[model samples]
Target: MTAAKPIRCLAFDTSMTCPGVAIIEVRKGKPTIKALSHVKPNTSRSHAHRAEVIEGWAMLFLDKHVGTAGFDYVVREDFAGKTSRSNYPVLSAWNACERATSRFGLTFAKYKKPGKDTEYLGISATRVKSLVAGSGNAVKDEVEAGVRRITGYAGTFANDDESDAAAIGLAWLIDAGVIEKPKGAG
Candidate 1:
């Protein structure tokens, strides 16, 4: 019997200063992290310039991966809320990511804030943490540790941003049934 083809996914945690990105492949319903990286914006520049630089970086990252064997899905963490005063930059970056992914005809799945509902498709942050760290309230380090434990990833993570991004991707894998739920997850 032949094995089922793997599903390749590109996931991101969008931010103004640094955005986390990961490419994963699911084979036989098991997800494996293939590549992980972050887009660091030049903070010395003005806000507008920073946004442009971040968008350009994001585009470059996507361009580099979109054609390499091609990705079957693109996922990202949704904005926390629209009312926050600091949401503008994040929204801008997210919009750019959406546009970039759409240009390739890929529908980006936006994982919403934990325990919230919106018109767009999403999975809550609480759900992501619970699935990834066995606790919805798991702190950054714990979540990062959980991701390494679950994926058996051996490389050192650059920062919490990348870890969170990886967690976001792992959440999508669990939600899509590409991977089994971690033990003790509620």
Candidate 2:
């Protein structure tokens, strides 16, 4: 059989207040983290201001790192909370991400369809935790530990936000059959 080509993925733990980001590259079924970061938008302003800030940040980030053809696809953690307070940030983040990705012409075009699809996806936090940490209810610390264990990342994650994004990326790779599931992960 022939070897599989490398696939790069950009994933986000998105929020208007602070959005975490991670890029994962898979070569021959092994995963590596290419970059990781998070942005804290000025919260003293209105939601519109926060959304614009997020959109600007995402656009700049994609332009610099992703360009026109950087990764295979982008994935964000699905909003999985009951609080209405969380709605503004999540919606704003998704809108900004969509706008940024659309600007870059990045969509869920794994098949390279002909027309404008403009599709993206979100992996649930429970599913991400389950796949990465072997438990759906795993907490932030455990998810961080699991991500470190899987990616062999030595440095500490600035916060769980970054780790969660990394976990989401890794889990997407595994779920899509792009990479084999890491040992001891669910």
Best by lDDT: 2
Clash pairs, model 2 backbone: none
Q: Top model by TM-score, which number?
A: 1
Residue 59 Cα positional deviation in candidate 1, in Å, after optimal superposition = 1.8
- lDDT string for model 2 (36-117, tens) is 8888888899988988888888888787788544788688777655776877678878888788888887763332112546
Evaluate model 2: give its TM-score. 0.85
**lDDT by candidate, in order shown:** 0.77, 0.79
lDDT of 1 by residue, 150-178 (tens): 78888878887788878888888887667
Clashing pairs in 1: 114-125
Deviation in Å, model 1, residue 94 alpha carbon:
0.3
Give the total clashing residue pairs for model 1. Answer: 1
**Clash number by candidate, in order:** 1, 0
Query: Any idea how many clashes model 2 has?
Result: 0
